[model samples]
Target: MADSAESAAVPIISTSTSTSIANVAASPAEDEAIPVQRKSSSPVTDPGTSPGQAAPINSAHEQSEQEDSDDDSALGAGSILSETTSLADEITQYRYEHNRRYHAYKDGEYWGPNDDKQNNQLDIAHHLYLLTLEGRLHLAPIGDNPQNVLDVGTGTGIWAIDFADQYPSAQVIGFDLSPIQPMWVAPNVRFEINDACDPDWGYKKNSFDFIHVRAMYGSVADWPAFYRQALAHLAPGGWFQQIEMSVVPTSDDGTVTEGSIFDMWGKISLEAGDKFGKDLRIHEQIKGYLDDAGFEEVVEKVYKWPIGPWDEDIHMKQIGLWNQLHWEEGIEGWSLALLTRVLGWSYTEVQAYLGKMRTGIRDRKVHAYHIINVVYGRKPIPS
Candidate 1:
């Protein structure tokens, strides 16, 4: 990414009007002014808005929040080597259990043996931190400088760490049920463990330049409320980017045999979502929510990701291979935890299901699919 794009942006901002576009119910519009990096005339909901596939919060415990925030803030601007070392220590000393009790929310976010390999291959934080520079995607709807960037349910603190590294001047925070971040790193990035829906976040009003949420598996109940909170924190011209996958099994050619193993996963997982009240329907209504939340200049980017092994392209094949490795060593840690802990499925059932899922990810049959929606909207800075 270009350094300019990596750093803070310099652009005129605008104030958002009532851009609500859906019948979806939302709190009274918390229309706020947000800065915009792109030029005028390009509206968020002008013509494009998809339904579902969207992904939020309220909460507070000022004492712990401040303490965690302070300690996290104290770590700043260091070599990646040193940071990695500290991260190792945190993971080793993790106090939270990733068993059948807690989902992948806090202190026990996966830091398994496969993490190092996965980071080398995908570099999750780099993907997220550099997204703002990808203006063509038009995903960063919030104005250039998203002052308060929150990574909900941050895992490994990877996304938050990189974002802070990229924007050393911005105040970035990562929250999870576990406190697994390094003790020494960039001052701008902080990690905390708390229920995101609590009422004591103690965030300044209209202050966050951006709020980025990812991997919305079972962590949020009311997405509209989540977006509403994002809207509330967004300064005019700010942006909220929610990136996620459907976890819904899909066919590359739109032809998945029900007899296929991937299809079995789709049935079982969708059933799981249904039983848990997880709103699998949200994937279809993402665009509507941003509009209702009064965020304009919305953009969505969809990429087809293969689960196990898919590579008609040479590059993707290499990534596919690496991901397969992650799937081998890391899949158990991630998949089983969510299945048994949150989905309430038995360990044996989840393991049996994963055997098929892992095969799909390996053989590219689970035909498992994902939709990465990079939804962004500026809070609207004054024109």
Candidate 2:
């Protein structure tokens, strides 16, 4: 088993662009399998707007719906309009690779699955994120209200919609590479199918008071450029918060073994991300990137998210259960493409490998947990 210290040293891609492309510095065995970061061959496509507007899914009556019920249904399924709304604005046709689906616009741009299963997993993960943070949508000190806000790579538009509801006066825009977000939303909130990698962003310069990016690790091709765009668009004194999960799981008590399947999954996934031009293991470098981007007062908070119901604290135990489900439900969707398409493994091989990874995830004795980093900084105010 590759231990945490050994795994942290391996570079997942060529370091031509940035030295921070390494996943973990694992032992020679792991390092030999993965190398430094390099540019991905897959081209990013323009994320188009939905075909047309539809009614928002969370209607007034739906407000009475319990949080538990919300957690049960897929992100957009609870709405009466889900059936029509999802298909209404078909900006790009669905494309498939290795029996799994990918967005057609930028064929191989996003390596993650976008089908119903993946969508539900994203929503469930959102629930877990909220639970872990004690229901605070963001840690940025935006105060009572802000006029303009942006949510980059807003999957299913859950966070944006919730933010809009929390601050009725603020206008929130949710941007993503897929048209998966529902058509209708809070009047102040709107969903746009667009790519964050584009250079000529349509927004006015320094117009947004807040920008929120969550779990967009595998999609962004250039971290420096992404932060530059955030800095450019943010209003003076505006806040930018990036929330991400580490691909590598850690054990504080030295329980998770080295060379574990979970570690291999992280290695292979990070390598796949390199092949596709995005690095999955860049969470640790976000703070420096923000600082280099000229942001001020940067702050980073890391949380230990357990993999199973193993923690003694009731809250942590519950978070672990949800986190476990989050991984269990999406494991295949997350691994199928990278393992088969990029790594050139047979489907059977991929499944066999995942079975082992799932076992590691479920074993409470492993004491396995991934770190969630929430880093936020303010766009420096003019002197």
Winning candidate number (TM-score):
2
lDDT of 1 by residue, 156-230 (tens): 666676566556446677776555456555555667665555444456567677777766554566777777877
Candidate 2 lDDT over 103-222, as tens digits, reads 755566677887777887887777766665556778789999788888998877778877877786677888777877766554667777677888745676787899999998887878
Clashes of 1: 66
Shift in Å, residue 319, candidate 2: 0.7
Candidate 2 residue-pair clash tally: 25
Candidate models: Cα lDDT each: 0.52, 0.72
Error of 1 at 151 (Å): 2.1
User: RMSD, each candidate, Å?
Assistant: 15.3, 14.5
In model 1, what is the error at residue 349, expressed in angstroms? Answer: 2.7
Worst 10 residues of 1 by lDDT: 1-10
TM-score of each predicted structure versus truth: 0.63, 0.76
